[model samples]
Target: MTITHRFLQIAAVAMLLGGCTSKPIYNAQENFSSNMGISENQMQRAIVTALHDRQWKIQSVKPGQIEAEITVRGRHHAEVDIPYSPTSFEIRYRSSWGLDYKNGEIHGNYNRWVNRLRDNVLKELSIDPNIEALNNLGAVKRDVESPSYFAFQEGVERATQAGLLDGSIQFYLSGQPVPGSAHHIRTVTSSRKTNGANKSDKDACIWALQSALVALQSAAKKAGANAVIDIASIDQRSLYKDANNYQCNAGTFMASVALRGELVTLK
Candidate 1:
């Protein structure tokens, strides 16, 4: 028979085996801004983080909604619509593949995935991104590489392995030396969100710096430049020039780092 008929037959057999069933669609309300006084932006961030943690790819984002899709093991796929407000949000079923959805019924696994996503969102919303929490956790560097700190060399190595960057490109701070003969291309800035949820400020700052370096290298390559020079921290529009360290804002859920540098070609 046709592929469609074959699929339907398989689904019918699966249904007969009780692997699929009808379930009420999940809708979450009061998931935000009750006693916490969170804004819509904060609610959006939490939801985004939760989705990322749950391996959901955001398909599109609108002012009041986010469309996301999740693929399980390159076979089953599910899509969801999340329309949110400062006071509430709802997760509605949009579509699915390999789930045998019919007449408002679907494989029981779909319900379980939605339920897990809801639980993660709730947990993320309840977390306090307070800087103090990270500070109290102590331990200065050493012992083990903190998940927060981004080692520069390690970052470079990773980029090289991924074929995105090379060691031939030089990176320098504002006070570092660049060959006087090098031709300046254009100045560029790279900013990245830091993982500040449960990381220490110092570690988060390091990670942000590493992330910025990778961006700069990518930009330089795109511009046919061999180096990024005169790097300066311009986070929040406040410029800080340091030879050995960059500036980072680490606290709460919004840790970030921004670096500006001149892209140049060396002889």
Candidate 2:
């Protein structure tokens, strides 16, 4: 539909004609509210309840693709300055897939399962105030598939919708959680080199730092992190103890915290 779709299609075809194969893009889908997963009605209820339970009055829920931020909540009515001032809530849901080529065909698999899972991962208002549920939109770390599927959906959005994927399309969504939200927002970035996946130099060190810098920048903006240290912060002695002999045509991206905005808070 857009220039991107056209470009990607062209690129995929070009690679195929060159006797190369590209990863087929998996499709992410959002099932109706009546599906087995959490319904929009239920999600809406959960969001509203989460806000109300936390003393954050519900303002509105915009279900559109264009809005930069999705859901918007307001403080208590007492905090209302205008007819609709600062929303007390902001929730957004997006899903996408990677482009994969199999048998000379692009595969667009439906990823609604993740959408369902995401809907079910509602805020745990019951958690203690000290404990917070920090779910990064892009912070996907997992040994799992469903959640990873969801992350793929979001990644596609970044590439297609958010315009983050200008280079080759990547298969991300580790489906694991880093450690804490306070550390930073979850972001995945990659870079590839020749020499066949060496664990020593550029593939391990310089290239890693380059990718990390990109990830850090992306995380900062996407996660709204407060600040980030120099790429040197990632102890060169550790992060990439092995970089030489980088994977030939093999790409690697290190996930890191992005931003530290005051987005997540207990009710």
TM-scores for every predicted model:
0.42, 0.19
> What are the lDDT scores of the predictions, listed in order?
0.69, 0.29
Task: Give the per-residue lDDT digits (tens) of candidate 1, residues 20-104.
Answer: 3656555554443253444688678878988999899999888789999999998889899999877777789999998777777
Instruction: Return model 1's CA RMSD, one decimal.
Output: 12.7
What is the lDDT, from 0 to 100, of the residue 42 in candidate 1? 67
**Poorest 10 consecutive residues by lDDT, candidate 1:** 138-147
Could you tell me the TM-score of candidate 2? Answer: 0.19
> Candidate 2, residues 90-153: lDDT per residue as tens digits?
2332222243324533322222222222333222211111111121222222223221001223
Best by lDDT: 1
What's the CA error at residue 87 for candidate 1, in Å? 0.9
Model 2, position 173, has a per-residue lDDT of 20
Model 1: residue 157 alpha-carbon error in angstroms: 50
